[model samples]
Target: MIGTLLTFLAVGIVSIVVVWIVLSVVGSLLGLTMTIATFLLFKVAPVMFLGWAALKLWAWARNNRGFLSAKDRRWLERE
Candidate 1:
């Protein structure tokens, strides 16, 4: 769990940095400035979706592998 969270955090940070750099260049060329509020409003939704997708993928993997832990199995059942 800790590792998964850390991995996501690292990926999210890197993704934000890359997106910011690209957007900054494009914005400059277009004479536009992105505000922080707009940035967060747009950016956070996708990051959140990514987290949700990761959970779904993890469940899929566990199901397909047929080695899910009892806790995970119960979690899936609850879902």
Candidate 2:
């Protein structure tokens, strides 16, 4: 009877420790994921948006060239 009780207690303690370790690992992974997401939002997103805007501006300028006269081009160059 005593041996059975001791075995049950040991198993219960081991299961608790295992659960605690698993939770700690999961929390660390969640923190790392949040950090990477924050970096992408703050650092990478602005540069990507700026590149997109620059491409659009360049396309508009290229399309605008067909309507301008030579005199307008000269005036623009002088300015």
Candidate 3:
């Protein structure tokens, strides 16, 4: 019957709409997760580089104390 067909069509449309909404929510969450990951990477990258630099400097100072003057050594030691 036409009434039964119309009812099925309405149900189908609503089901599609619900699925679309769920997919949108999932997409937003994925985008937010990626944004947070990138933000964290940006935040930690400089600290990582500075740590590497400090390690390099320490190794250099250990092997070549004469390369740095007494005042420079004092300043590095203070840090």
Candidate 4:
């Protein structure tokens, strides 16, 4: 019957609208997550890299020169 068909059409339209709204909300949330993740990566990467480099340098220095001596500490304390 025409009434049944109309009812189906209306239900289809409502469902489509609801699905569209849900998809858009999900899309926006995904975009926000990506942006925040990228921002954190950029902000944190340099500090992390520098820290890693410093650790490597310290290890190298420790291996090459050994630990700081008492003379070195005394010289530093003089200043």
Top TM-score hit = 2
Where is model 1 more than 4 Å wrong at Cα? 32-79
Q: Per-residue lDDT for 1-79 in model 4, tens only?
A: 9999999999999999999999999999999999999987998888899999999998898968767779988998999
- Each prediction's TM-score against the native? 0.37, 0.77, 0.59, 0.71
lDDT of 1: 0.87
- Candidate no. 4 TM-score: 0.71
Q: Rank the candidates by TM-score, best first.
A: 2, 4, 3, 1
Q: What is the lDDT of candidate 4?
A: 0.93
Alpha-carbon RMSD, each predicted model: 24.5, 8.4, 7.1, 6.4
Tell how far residue 32 is off in model 2, in angstroms.
Answer: 0.4
Model 3: per-residue Cα lDDT over 1-79, one tens digit each: 9999999999999999999999999999999999999987898888998999999999988778657778888999998
lDDT of 1 by residue, 1-79 (tens): 9999999999999999999999999988665445655677799878988999999999899779879788977999997
Record all residue pairs in model 4 with backbone atoms less than 3 Å apart, i.e. clashing. none
| Worst window of 10 by summed lDDT in candidate 1 | 29-38
Candidate 2 colliding pairs, count? 0
- Poorest lDDT segment (10 consecutive residues) of candidate 2: 63-72
Deviation of model 4 at 9, angstroms = 1.5
Q: Which stretches of candidate 2 lie over 4 Å from their true place?
A: 67-79
